[model samples]
Target: MKQAIYYAQLTKKANEYLSCLYDIAQTLVSFDDYDDAKMYLVKISQYKITDHVIKEKAMQDLINVQRILTGLEDRYEKEDDLQKKMSLAEKCADTYSCLDRNERSKYYYLKQLKHAQELNLNEDQMATIYSSLGSIYQDLKEWQLSIDYFRREMSCRIGLGIQADIE
Candidate 1:
């Protein structure tokens, strides 16, 4: 009980720091400083904030950063530095990857499909990935995969006997 309280307090503090970092990044974006904005976004992501609200906010911030990154990538026409261009592209993809494709999240279901094929995400990671997939499928009225992924997640949660506020 005491440990849980301590953990919660720590998470709250980290969340506050993340919020500050996000503001700095937003300011950089407003100034057309894409590199600095991306750097700050990555830094904020390193802050450990397990509180559901904070984590959700952080994920949303990542999605926003991804959009900005996309615009930046498009604006840069020079391709003299192949490695740098590749690195920037990868970072842009990674930014989108941070956002789960839930209803609240701004990601498309196709992102999860591409992710599952590209990365062999494990059960916990898969749960997050597949849940997002499930939600999108549900929205599109595609019942088969939606039911399959949802049941897979439910089975895993039941096996772990973990209390999940999935709904």
Candidate 2:
């Protein structure tokens, strides 16, 4: 990895530099070093890689992840079981959240909330989802929406006999 970084810097040509960055990023992703992988991937994007294969591999697997999310959404829509729908929604939400696609995450979380309500899930289970939605709204600077969800979460916690210090 150090060698790859050194070669990436040492290379004068754009193609060589991009290839080295791709290699480093690919290796990082395989090791679950996503933070480092994201760094190298961003570096690759900064340079124009004429090679499409290198571009696809380095730029994501991210492209494929979106495909996977879409597939999950399609399956969720077609699914007859509420449990399965919740699971799919969770996968989509978590993936979108990790990608910093908060709007998409919000969508799935809403779906999950709907399913949980339909299933009569305990307040404890729903509370965390409310908290997540609250934080998401906060991140997007939707103050009233954030306060609404936080209030809902607070209600859930209270209903579950959990005491919290409210500010």
Candidate 3:
């Protein structure tokens, strides 16, 4: 009886969180405000719900909401500001990574690399890209590729006179 009651309470709390998430999504659609939507999605995604299904669905919704806000192809082409364009690409890469779509993440990361190179962004900025690529490759267990990217990142940091432990 106690177990049943505990489970009932858990289910009720989970349902409430799901309902709140759905309400936020509806509000986003109605307001057409991507920033606010992203904020809400971030909050919901970080929330700790005891239900696995609800948590998974909330994560998926967060990814979808982020994609709707970023709109890589459309926004990337239409954006005139270099900084904003780079930001969108980064957001796309992050969202894809969160979804475990590593290929898409790499695609956007490569795009960011190209943009950074073309715009002559500082070593610090480029290093961030290199570090991200290194992390991705490490996750993929591509040891040689990961080492190369990490080396590139280290080189950038060295160029900027930033001392870091190589170990």
Error of 3 at 151 (Å): 0.6
Sorted by TM-score (best first), the order is: 3, 2, 1
lDDT, candidate 2, at 81: 93
Tens-digit lDDT track of model 3 for 126-160 = 88998988887787788888887898799788884
Residue pairs clashing in model 2 are none
Q: lDDT per residue, candidate 2, 30-58, as tens digits? A: 56566666777766666664566677665
Instruction: Please give the RMSD of candidate 1 to the true structure.
Output: 13.0
The order of the candidates by lDDT, greatest first, is 2, 3, 1
Q: What C-alpha lDDT values do all the predictions have?
A: 0.54, 0.73, 0.69
Q: Specify the highest-lDDT model's number.
A: 2
TM-score, prediction 1: 0.32
TM-scores of the models, in the order given: 0.32, 0.58, 0.58
Error of 1 at 3 (Å): 60
